[model samples]
Target: MTLTNRQRAVPPSMFADETLMELPPPVRLTGIGLRFYVDDEGRGSATPALIRGQLWPLDTAVTDATIREHLRALVKVGYIETYSINGRKLLALTDWPSVDRGSRSRLPAPPSTEPLARSSRASRETFAVEGGGEEGREDGREEGAGEGGRGPSRDARDETEPSPFCRKHQPHGTDFACGGCASARKRHDQWLRAEAEAEAEGLAE
Candidate 1:
């Protein structure tokens, strides 16, 4: 898959999403990494071996099982959906397009041994679901099953839900701060540090 090497937009709501806020930090970071690495379609393989090999120099004490558990946690929280293709697992981020505020691309049809695999034509059909911000079912079938399967519910409260961090702005993600409020705080801290450093230099002279 050809992935764009540009900065992906991470909504502040991600930090506030009840689904994400409850996850362990490593899992949350992994989810963010997934967004960065995957194609616009949010298609990628996050097998334990790949994650361990690629996800930076983590402590050796953290076993593959732990990583797998984190991946499962992401799935459970509705941030990702997993599909089995030819005995291999493929994951798709459910809310990527919404978070990026762009049109989602069609998933490349996988070569599959399973009969559930769709034809090329069907695969090209857009997988866009209305209100894709909601949590998927516990079973992990966000799009539902069979001909009559009722898919998971959309996050109706995404717009209406107030962020815990900012009253005016919805929740967003940041390394140290959230949205506008946290960014303001960061700038304020930097200004204070610069002032303090200048004062110390003058006193020494």
Candidate 2:
């Protein structure tokens, strides 16, 4: 789906790095990291060490692996840039778009976020129920295999409502754009780095 900045959701503790790892899988950890990026620094940009001391609660336990996993998820999502600091891996959010704000291009590249894989017929069934097929079934009726083989209840279907990852959200390109290799993007420009800097400074179009 097309997303304006307001429509996009970034979690609060995204920069928590390691501490986030302690939270339950997926959402909480990601949420913490999100907040860290957008909140603590006021820049949505941070290094793990730069953030650790600031994010922890007065008594929250700590570990390096937690920070690493948080960073790993961010890197996978394309929200952050990564590098090596001496011997340790480091990460920070993308400070600015590769080009100007609202600057139309082919399509901006989708972040490298890894899609979690779900296996198991039962699990797949659960996912399908929760996330509708490409058609996006709000009415919530399964077309096949109801009681013994009949369709599902309207209520059952409704309860199974799919979230964004529902097949419906991922169309060919309108949801995003192509990155030449089937990856998604807005567009590309040789001078993109310059444009990004100017935009970051609020001095460019």
Q: TM-score, each model?
A: 0.46, 0.31
TM-score of 1: 0.46
lDDT of each: 0.52, 0.37
Per-residue lDDT for 1-205 in model 2, tens only? 1112223344333443332333456435443445434422223323554444444334245444555565665444434545543445444344332322433422222223222121122433664576567563445544433343223333443353322221222443233321121212311221233234323432221
Per-residue CA lDDT of model 1 for 1-205, tens digit only, reads 3234546777787777655775788888877877776666567776776665556445686567977887788776556667776777777665545435544544443332123213321321233243233553334433532222332122321232223333323345344333334433433344445444433433454
Instruction: Work out how many backbone clashes candidate 2 has.
Output: 30
User: Positional deviation of 136 in candidate 1, in angstroms?
Assistant: 35
Which portions of model 1 show Cα errors greater than 4 Å?
1-6, 98-205
lDDT score for residue 127 of model 2: 43
Model 2 scores what on Cα lDDT? Answer: 0.37
Q: Which parts of model 2 have CA positions greater than 4 angstroms off?
A: 1-47, 84-90, 95-205
